[model samples]
Structure formats: structure tokens, C-alpha cells
Target chain A: MTAIHTGELVDRIGEAVLADPAVVRLDGGPFQTIATYLPGRRVVGVTAADRITVSVVLRLDQPIPAVAAALRERVRRVAGDLPIDVHVNDLESKEEPV
Target chain B: MVTTNSQNDLRDAVPAARQSPAPARLADENGQGKTTIASNVVQKIAGMAAREVSGVHAMGGGMSRAFGAIKERIPGAGTSSTAGVSVEVGEKQAAIDLDMIVEYGASIADLARAVRRNVITAVERMTGLEVIEVNISVEDVHLPDDNGGDEAPEKSRVE
Candidate 1:
């Protein structure tokens, strides 16, 4: 029941994050910079039907690919068959000096 | 905690120091004592629900995340975000209050309705959490897509 649903929920979010190109975009997305917990923290192992979704504020100037790849790999390692969607809310580009 | 008899009452009152209280099961899978999966679970569940619509920006509004972090510093919060998302253990049901920012060009009523339907369908099918209400609050609308960077769009989504 609830336990199962929660697992599915985690998987879906992961998928959603992985699917979004913008999420992978380095300059603006939070993939590498953001602190991931839970499903994100469980990246050491993989499971069937794994998907995850994440959100973060990232430096907009960087490319999003690294974040996406790292995230996907992490989710795959921990929860296999997982889909992750990571959305960026606030982005600060490195082009502009902090 | 309830005890049926005097012996049981003694056991309950005694607070068995020897038995390290079972790790608080925030959300267990296969009774393996898995608590590290609670926040990500709720966050992702809500994320799946929120993005189906055209306008949603992300989960955890400034206020909620801020307060959630604040609550984290305090000892009482067993888990973050769990307080917000409600659940029925046996029924495997859950509900969430969604906050979103609608983009320009989409109809508020139409977008909200579409979001509601999608959220319910996705959450129920994927998580088995019976969403009681996909209540939506359109927080803000950004500059129109045509308005160009930094400039306010000709028309506002909310107005």
C-alpha cells in the first residue's frame, strides 16, 4: 500500500526529471548544485520501475547536461526503470559575477 | 499506548530501555526499516502531479519550503513534507495542496482543470494515493513569451 505508492511516486519523479531537456541544461538548472534527499540519496542501488522528479535553484550560466546525467545515473543505480523529472525554479547564471 | 493487563501496564510504563525503540518507520518498504525515502517520495509525487499542466513552475513555494526548513531545525518533525501530505496507511491514500505559477497564453480555468484531472489520474495510477483534492492556487504569471527577456509581456496571465 502506502509504502508501495511512495516508491512509485519516487520513481515517477525521477523519470520526469530525466525526461526534461531544460532540467539537464547546465547553465540554469540545479542538478549538480542541489542537495538531493530520499530517492535522490538512494542512488547506490537500482530497482525495477524506478522514476524520480526533482526541483532546484541552479546557476543559470552552466550547462544542464551534467546534472541530468548524474541524476539519471544515480536514480538508475538506486531505483531502476525509474523516470525522473527535474525542474529548475530559480537560475543564476555564472556569466554574471556573483 | 494501551495495555490490557497490569503486567502489560508495567511493561509499558517501564519504558524498556533495553529495547532500542524501533527506528521510527517514516515510510517502510518490506518492513526493512526504510525511512530515508519519505521527503523525496512526497516531493516527487507532487512534482509528477504539478507538471502535467502547462503553467506549473515547481513544487515547494517560498513559504512552504522556508517553513519546512525551519521545522527541520526543530526536533519534533519526524520527517519534512510528511506533515503536509496526508496518507491512510491501509488504504494507501494521500492528498496534496498544489501551488503553481501559470504561464501567459493559457486559460486559467482551462489550465487549472487540465492540471487537476492529470494530477488525480497520475497520482492515483502511479502512487495509489487517493488524492482527495487537487486544489490549485495560481501564484504568479511571468512576462508573456513574446514580451522578450526582462520586459513585461503585453498581457499578463493572471490579469
Candidate 2:
């Protein structure tokens, strides 16, 4: 298996997580701790280390656990051997206010 | 905070017949992830559902309703949909409490029942969280004559 760089891995995971319809946006965990600090920019809500952590705000249309499970599955395909931690920090309604 | 062993224990506790029909609703140990639903989301859903019932004239007690009226007049101070609705949401279940004003002549008991059913259905279906209980409190009754005071304000002496 070809090893991917940490920076690239973070981007890949971010893209994958966002592709899921249930996820509204990435969230920086408490105090903005969960993130990947790059040269000039940092990706919020995703960190790569001993274990990968991703926090997100999800839409309320689906079951929370089901969405979490799907997210982990998607991240796992990109992350390979690293364990993943998914945090669903908040939920948003699907309807738009008039 | 959920560990693999605890998930295994939960799996073992469930009846075999029940386990075969559906996937587990709770988070599993296989690194699937953890999901937390904010209480306010459930509160909003419950509030909307309660208002859908015919007899519910409004939500909240006298003081809150008065406050809500004043808040509505201010720019960018939109009315709170969750007013008079409180919810406790757990990983897999939720409980809701509602304060409501009913229209006069409506049967309180029947109205409560209808509101409870709608709230449970809406919350469970929308959020996928089991609504264990919905407690309804009828705070007041809205009389038709009561609108006279609210509809017409006293003329200002200066104006």
C-alpha cells in the first residue's frame, strides 16, 4: 500500500466527510483542538496523529449513529490503518426559514 | 466514552430475534463513531408539532408570551420556535416537556393527547431519536374576549 502524506490525508478525509449529505460542516472540537495545522492554513475538525479525529455538525434528517457509522466507513477507506474518532457536535434543520 | 466491551455487552443483552431484524440503532464499538444531538433541535421539533394541533392557541406561560410579543417587535429579534418547549436528548432517546395555552371550550385532556402524539411522531421521525415521554402542561386558556386588550393599545397622550 502506498503511504499518503498527513497533509494530503487531512484533505482527503475532509473532502470525503463533506461529501456525505448528512454532514453540514466540519467543527473544531472544544477550544479548537481537533485540527491539522499546515504551513499557513489549518483544517478545522480533522486531526491526524496516533488516531484520526473528525468533528462535524450534522443534519437532523438521518439517525445520528447511522450517519456516524457511514462517516467512519468513508474515512477508514482513505485513512487505512489509523483509528478514527467521529464527533457529532451539533445538528441543523433541513428546512429554510422564509 | 463508549467502549468496545460495553457494546458487546449490549449486543449480548438483546434478544436474538430482535437483533436479526434491524441494525443496531446505538453507536457500536467498531469505531463507527459517536453522534450527539443538541437538545434544542428536539425542542424545536416538539414545539412545531405541538402547534400543529388544533386546540393549541399558543405556547409558553403568560410571562413568556408577553416577552415573546415584545421581542417580535424588535428588529432582527425573531420569535423563538422553541419557546415553552424543553427537551432532554440522549444518544438514542429523548424526552420532551411543553407549556401551552389552549383555546377556551376545547377539551384539555383531548388536546393534550393530540399534541403528545404529534410531538412524538415528529421528533422520532425527524431526528431518529426515540421519544420516551412527552409531558404537557396547560398553562392557561385563551378567551376570545381577551384579544380586545391586546388588539387595541391605548392612544398616547403626546401623539
- Leading candidate by TM-score: 2
Quality class of the docking in candidate 2, CAPRI style: acceptable
Scored against the true structure, residue B53 in model 2 reaches a CA lDDT of 97
Q: Is the docking of candidate 1 incorrect, acceptable, medium or high quality?
A: incorrect
User: Per-residue lDDT for A1-98 in model 1, tens only?
Assistant: 24545556545544544454433322212234332235445421222222344554344333333443455555545455434443333333345322
lDDT of 2 by residue, A1-98 (tens): 22347788899999999999999989885567778888778889997776677888777566666677788889989887555777766566668531
Q: Where does candidate 2 chain A have its weakest 10-residue lDDT segment?
A: A89-98
> How many clashing pairs does model 2 include?
0
For each candidate, give its TM-score against the true structure: 0.36, 0.67
Measured against the true two-chain complex, the DockQ scores of the candidates, in the order shown, are 0.03, 0.38
> Model 2 chain B, poorest ten-residue lDDT window?
B23-32
lDDT of 1 by residue, B1-159 (tens): 121223444456656783355432222222211212223343444555567466654444556656767877875352343323332222234556666666766788988888778867665544334567666776666545534764654586686
Residue A65, candidate 1: Cα error in Å is 32
